[model samples]
Target: MKTTSITHRLADLGGAKWDLHTAARDRSDRGEDIVEMTIGEPDVALPEPLARAATRAIEAGRTQYSNGRGENGLRDALAESYSARRGRCFERDNVLCFPGTQTALYAVMQGVAETGDEVLVGDPLYATYEGVIRATGADMVPVPLKAEHGFRMQADDIAQRITERTRAILLNTPHNPTGAILRPAELEAIAEIALKHDLWLISDEVYEDLVFEGNSFTSPLTLEQIADRTIAVSSISKSHAAPGMRSGWAIGPRGFMDALLPVSETMLFGNQPFIADVTEEAVRAGSTVADGMRQRFAKRAQYLADRLEAETVLRVHRPEAGMFALVDVSPLGMDCDAFAWALLENAGVAVMPGSSFGAHLQNWVRLALTVEDAAMTKAVDRISEFARSVAVAAQ
Candidate 1:
């Protein structure tokens, strides 16, 4: 008799981070102390305004299903807020809200590319991107982000990789793992490449609101030439510390959004109205909360980088924004996966191996600055000791 089988795309995908997270959780359940620095979740509390707004909506019975494109009021607020940030006017029709940024990204990929198409992505990218691209049946073409250049995706590199089959370029500013923020000129250059190749630009700006003092956040929508082809995906998850709310949206050309609506409908039907209402309030009034969290994360990133540099053999790549730093642990004479596993087993600390992001990052590890100061300090101390032990063993 024949047996049911999983699709090749799904079978080929790997969730290394989730696997490590589960391992860490299991160890903790067994009474071992585990300092989780594997995921990019914020340690901050959700802003009171968001919570209050959500409660008000729920009490007022605003729990019905919203339009697939989102409620008009929330879309209007997002349009106004994002227009101000991107320097481009966006109408309500330009937005499609999803349960989360991950869903938004997947829907956009499905709407833009089909099977046999190619999408260029930066190496050392967020791990889920590969799965999403594969799920859409589009081949993910990796454009190497050189560490020598701080892992910033160069426009020339993108231009060099484009083929007739290339449908889009996926970007994450203030990127995960590396936390390298793209400069305005770099964005402009990339925009030009997208225009030249007639390719779509999917810019994930979830970390836009978390930028540090010196760096500025520029949206791909700002480029008038590529505005029509660019889809800006963002959420209040990282910035407002509201991941559980699952509020996120994609802003693009109305035509593209029209095409994406069915995908969102099929995948999610629609987001909860209460969540959209809460998101609207968060967008309008939660800047102070977001700003305070960003400042704290920036400080935490610096503190962790400083500690790693002084205490451990790892070379830290201090991020300009976002909640993670990439540390080169090759000095310990082991690959990143080995180092991470050993650290988790021996030191009770869990960090993501850089190879989980991209093959080129095999000798690196990503440390999330989401833990409290005391825990972060203690985790670093354990990492330092582990590094020293490995070095001594090597000698």
Candidate 2:
């Protein structure tokens, strides 16, 4: 009578990362007035057309299970979208639909790496990345994303870390937790390393639509040389503000997609047809909410950075894209965990400690940029005052 080793592998991944956020929740449950800024839940609501599409599908009796690779129409729409953006032709066979990016990444990890292998991902990544890699019985190798570089994962850093055991390089751009987008040249460099090492390049591009005016996103799938080695996963969760729909897909070489088909079937043979129809319509119509999120996120992030810099000892690493703002709390004379807890208890604001992402981020803390101006201003006001007290006491 025994559970499996994989259970032990992933048992440590889920609960503890959200300790501060959990504590914040408990305090708020006790009738406390708490301003929660830890989770990256999109503040925006789903657009009318998308919602109508879902309703229409349900009325049309489109609630059955989809095919193993998803409905042909949705896959075709996804292939067309990526083909237009990447300048590389894609077909339905190259796209495999999943419930969301989390599931897509999990299947891709199982397809690309396995027991005793390694997958290189940027440190201070989205917290669930390690869990997915570990679930496949592979080790997630960390390549530090330095603050000096805006926390963008460096090509050289990734290159230096690749070993013979390395089976793939997992990329998230525009990255989560830090909102650092990789440049086209940097992606080309990474493709070269993958080519030289014969490794898979698995990209998480869920934040692709959120790039601001001055920034752009490039996927490794664009490189002709590594065409067969690249796999990308994304969802309408952020782009369309459609997280509850749980619709996403993976695009990769035909062979990889072919190999992953049975795995997708065994796990969850199909997505909800009604949701797939809605996702297809979304892909065809394109993202309507991304621009609004980009504008609001940029504006709020800049205001937070400016206020922190002018009024307190904390510094924000300005982001190029995506929704979260990374603030360096090292000047508070305490680590991010200590600073975050005290800020929550004393100021009624809750943000995640850097340790939730990785050790490299321990001196920093992350707050969601989805809050409105008034609430953001209030949170920063409390943060500034709390910071001043710490600074004065340290002096």
Model 2 TM-score?
A: 0.98
* Colliding residue pairs in candidate 2: none
Cα lDDT tens digits, model 2, 53-164, are: 9899999999987789999999999999999999999999999999999999999999999999999999998999999999988899999999988888888999888889
lDDT, each prediction: 0.87, 0.92
TM-score of 1: 0.96
Per-residue alpha-carbon lDDT of model 1 for 1-395, expressed as tens digits?
65333267766566545677789989989999999998888677787878888899999999987777898899999999978887889989999998889989989999878888999999999988988898888899999998888899999899888999999999999798788888889999998888888899999999988888888877788889887899989899988899998889999999999987888888888889999899898888755566776777788788877877887677888888888888899888889889989999999999888878888799999888888888888998898888888888888
- Candidate 1 lDDT trough over 10 residues, lowest sum: 1-10
Question: In lDDT terms, which candidate is top?
Answer: 2
